[model samples]
Target chain A: MIAIHGFSPSGNCHKLRMLLEPLGQPYDWVEVDSPNGATRTPEFLALNPNGKVPVLQLQDGRTLTESNAILYYLAQGTPFLAEDRWARAQTLSWMNFEQYSHEPYVAVARFIAGWTPLDSPRRAELPRLRERSHQALAVMERHLQSNDWFSAGAYGIADIALFAYTDVAEHGGVALAPYPALRAWLARVRATPGFVPLPEPDALAADRIAQTA
Target chain B: MIAIHGFSPSGNCHKLRMLLEPLGQPYDWVEVDSPNGATRTPEFLALNPNGKVPVLQLQDGRTLTESNAILYYLAQGTPFLAEDRWARAQTLSWMNFEQYSHEPYVAVARFIAGWTPLDSPRRAELPRLRERSHQALAVMERHLQSNDWFSAGAYGIADIALFAYTDVAEHGGVALAPYPALRAWLARVRATPGFVPLPEPDALAADRIAQTA
Candidate 1:
């Protein structure tokens, strides 16, 4: 069985757990709490020098980092990935957008709100992060207005990639009220069989998020 | 023939050109000056709602965004993408690292140096960007010390994706002198068959970069 080293509240880590459940692939989950600096330790660094979750470890002990890459690895032969060449590329484009444009702002804002203290200096970054996060959401909204899914006309890894962050965006103070289409798409993703919701933040983290809010 | 809408000096766009040259594939290059607000125009947005480059338009009029995705699209079934599944996923892990960890700092630093005026407030970001850029470089250096290539144990799209920004990192005030292994890898990429150097920055951009130095 594959073992995933992950932080439960992280959208990046949730991307893998969400997909694996629906794919019916059994895997062990190793909680690596990133906020407490576990990822930076030498022991964890040996698994992934990049030191971010989620890291997928094969039963043979080889490991893979970067949540989206792990999704691609697990989904390629499955229905979660498109078979057509162009469709696969299109799916990859959205995943890249998720990592580059969306996650940086959306996920970081959520991290600041939930993981950092209420008065943390990183809170100063929220306005700009929120602005950029909205821009990314707007792009998704525009696409969703015309199409049903982010991946080659289906709810696949691209949707999974974007969904993980977007669903929890309000934790970052990014409201979904303006994007009806995007909200509908989010519901569609939830309706997928074997879907699993991201774990809620722990009590302390929730307090931070509430105070920041 | 395929048509590539790109900005010549962008590492993202150059990834496609660099690979296409070696692949002996014929394509039309439509230079879209992204630095001048070209990408934000409605027409360009039609091609890529994310309003970024490079956008690959197939002869059939299908478009693909994200430089790495375009590379994956063009490289599939070629030696550029690995045939083995695990190797292919490893390649993607590196590419994801480039976008998520490396390019956001290295490429953005370069943009601030070359595209923005020297006195622009964005220049304030340089010190931190360079610190993170070096951190990314250090990881690459560690990997290159033991391995010769980034993709499937060979020179391919992962190299191309990383090479785009790394080769121009000095423009971002990121000195390459410390990492001998990374420098050697850069040299090897340059020596690859059909390698094409990134085009020179325009006079105004060159001047901005020089002033920052």
Candidate 2:
């Protein structure tokens, strides 16, 4: 069994769970709540010096960090990842887009709104984050207008990577009401085999997000 | 021949040039000055909505965006990319690390220093950027203490991805004097076959960086 160290509420961490559930891979979950200083602990740092989750530990005790990298590792040779060379590269392009273009704005906004205290200074960054978040969403909407999926003509890890944070963008004050095609694409991803939605934010996070909204 | 649209000074754009040079692939280079608003033009945006440089155009006219993705596409089946599944995943992990943890700090600091005026308000971000940039270098230093190369026991695309920004990090106000292992790794990368250093910053950029320094 694979051992995954992750925080349940984190989109980056949840990406592993969502992908593995569909792959039917049995794995153990070791919760490491980063926002509360769990990730800063020496034990977690020993697992990943970068101090991020989820870290994937193979049965042989070797570990891999970075959520999208973990997805790529686990999805290899499976239908979850593309087999064609160009298609695979395209998949990787979208994954990089998720990490660089999309997540930094969308996911960071969510972290600030939900995880931080109500009066946290990070909230000052919301306006810029929201604008960039919408820009990323616009790109996704444009792509979805012509293609039904982001993951190389199929629902795969690319979709999983984007969907993890995008589906909960509302918590970040990013509404999806304007993106009709993106909304439809989200539905298609939800209908994929063995699909499991990310757990709802905890009560504290939900309350903070509500107050911020 | 592949057609590459890139900014001459940007490390992300230069990653492709470094890799393709070593691989001995014939390619055309179209100068896209992203800092001068070239990427925002309709023609360039049509090619890549992300408005970033290092966009690779295939012979069939399909364009691939994101520098690391382009590297993976070009390096596939070459010795630069590993044949073993685990090693390849590890390579992808380091590439992802370069984009996520390293580039955002190191590369962005370089842009703020060189592209913006010396008195630009963005310069205020330098201290924070420097701190995070050092954190990223520390991670690389730790990894280098045990491994000679980043990708599957060989000098490959992962090293290229990191070296692009790290070699020029001093321009971003990040000194390598403290990181002996990382400095040694940089030297090793410089010695690799067919290696070409990143181009020096343009006159305007160099002047601004000098003023900031």
Judged by DockQ cut-offs, is candidate 2 incorrect, acceptable, medium or high?
high
Off by over 4 Å in 1: none
Off by over 4 Å in 2: none
For model 2 chain B, where is the 10-residue window of minimal lDDT?
B204-213
Residues A108-172, model 1: lDDT tens digits = 99999998888789899999999999999999999999899999998899999999999999998
Question: Tens digits of per-residue lDDT for model 1 on B95-164?
Answer: 9999999999999999999999778998999999999999999999999999999997999999999999
Candidate 2 pairs with clashing backbones: none
Q: What would the per-residue lDDT of candidate 2 be over residues A1-213, giving only the tens digit for each residue?
A: 899999998999999988888788899999887888998899888989998988999999899999999999999989989899899889999999999999999999999999999999999999999999999999999999999898889888999999999999999999999999999999998898888888888899999999995
Interface RMSD of 1: 0.5
Best by lDDT: 1
Q: Score each candidate by Cα lDDT.
A: 0.93, 0.92
- Every prediction's TM-score for the first chain? 0.98, 0.98
lDDT of 2 by residue, B4-106 (tens): 9998888998898888898888999999978889999999999999888889999999999999989999998898999898998899999999999999999
Q: Which run of 10 residues does model 1 chain B get worst, by summed lDDT?
A: B204-213
